[model samples]
Target: MIMYTAGDVRVEERPDPKIIEPTDAIIRLTATCICGSDLWPYRGVEPADHTAMGHEYVGVVEAVGDDVRNVKVGDFVVGSFVISDNTCEICRSGYQSGCVHREFVAGTIGTQAEKARIPHADGTLVPTPGQPDEDLIPSLLAASDVLGTGWYGAVAAEAGPGRTVAVVGDGAVGLMAVLAAKQLGAERIIAMSRHPDRQELARFYGATDIVEERGDAGVARVKELTDGLGAHSVVEAVGTQESTMQAINSTRPGGRLGFVGVNYDVTIPGIDLFFAGIHVEGGPAPVRRFLPELIQLIWDRKIDPGRVFDLALPLDEAAQGYKVMDERRATKVLLTL
Candidate 1:
């Protein structure tokens, strides 16, 4: 077993975790991610100290409890970054990510560790067709966090055919929002980007336009493109006051705004929002709501979300992974156990 302690995470052999209840399962992690939200806790923005740090992972079920009916030992599984048993009232309502008995797997289950003890296994884990090819693991892991968040953002934005969508921010989730809009049949996608590399990737992911400028200049460009009506939908992928304002201002009256950035120093202006007449919606993206469909999309190779991960590091180099993302040297970092 590995430990995520204060200061830094380390690997050491310990007693293997066992099924503490019939609903529990043991997952031998194959791949995991260093999430952008994890940064809040790691950077002391959240009161996290010596907490198990990680929320996204893909793995094989090493063992299963007797009562666990959906998954079995030896099956390949991809679980949401947040764990929830699918049978709860909320799960049945398609909000398993917020199930009444939901138990997040990040800190307690600790996906960053080599192995994880998952509770509410049936509701939390979704099985794939078979052991995925090595190249597919990263994409599967994306299903656990960024991909789901992006998909949720798009859905919330009301992305669809004939809709013009503007995506604020260029993080992995933002880039995936571009992909999600395209997949959902949006007629045009404007990716607000300043970095050439991210801009190129945005285009490759199906962004029909690129706004190199930001703030008011970016909003002006969006208006110019939309005949002064602004886009019909706006995706806010960076949780900041500036990006939030940019998203709100970029949408036309009656348009929808989907925001998924983990809010940091973000305060919505009541007057601006009310007068914009844009329908704003979003939160801690209910990823589990979209996991089944996204998992199938990956399985069929209809889309590849793994491309957002630009760097891979051993789990031991987790701190470096954080530094790389903080320094903007990598679009995203994948941690291998």
Candidate 2:
């Protein structure tokens, strides 16, 4: 997929990716998908500039560089959206997304094509237990980004036993956050949304409450459910200023807020943040850090993140995929190769 300009993406033939670094490996992607983040550039919120698209992928290693040893040709693997050495001090501290050598996989190495070249393969890719079944591909592919992102949001918010986790978005990431909060043992998961379909899915993902309201009304509903103290943990998967503030106001003092949304214009006054006195953690999720555990859960059939893809189109139809998402017609679109 190539975006010639904002809202003008098309599937165009591009040069095939080959190893340019000894630490690189080329993989024949079996599955790839359009992400919520992809919409930023597509919607003109971010630059497109004839950019190559897609970052989430799952595939078989087609070839490997001499320096690569962790995975070999024929290995079915999943990699992170961000490339990381996975050995630097930051990565060792569990923040691979912030590694000294970090590189985003989006525009530089578009995985929406039949194949892609991956750098830092040793640290970025994790092979599955074995060859995955056809039905498992989507779920496995999801571990590359959305599922891992949601899991990070949950973990950052400290969603666990006796905690009330309120997710302030009903997109794929938000729905996945609801699932993550459940897996993390959050006692009450509150999914904030007005969409009936999303609300239903949230329930299936273990949400005990739903806030159909927005802004102040939404915060009041959450507070009502939490006895006016606000939720113990709040996940902000929507990156707008309104959504961010809603998440902040919905959190109790001394509670935690995990923000995984990718909006750039969101700003908060220092006084408000200082007075809120809430613990805040968020940013691009370190998906590589949780790939192992997420893969296991999917392999064991403990969670079905694949259901998040309500729309599927061949790689050629990515333009339509972007349209549907931009128009709110689909929560997610899985681009099949």
* Winning candidate number (TM-score): 2
Taking the tens digit of each residue's C-alpha lDDT, what string does model 1 give over 43-122?
66666645777788889999998889999999999888777877778878877767888777766767887888888888
lDDT of each: 0.86, 0.94
lDDT of 2 at 242: 91
Q: Quote each prediction's TM-score.
A: 0.95, 0.99
**Model 2 residue 129 CA deviation in Å:** 0.6
Model 2 earns a TM-score of: 0.99
Clashing pairs in 1: 86-123
**Model 1 poorest 10 in a row by lDDT:** 1-10
Model 2, residue pairs in steric clash: none
Q: RMSD, each candidate, Å? A: 1.9, 0.7
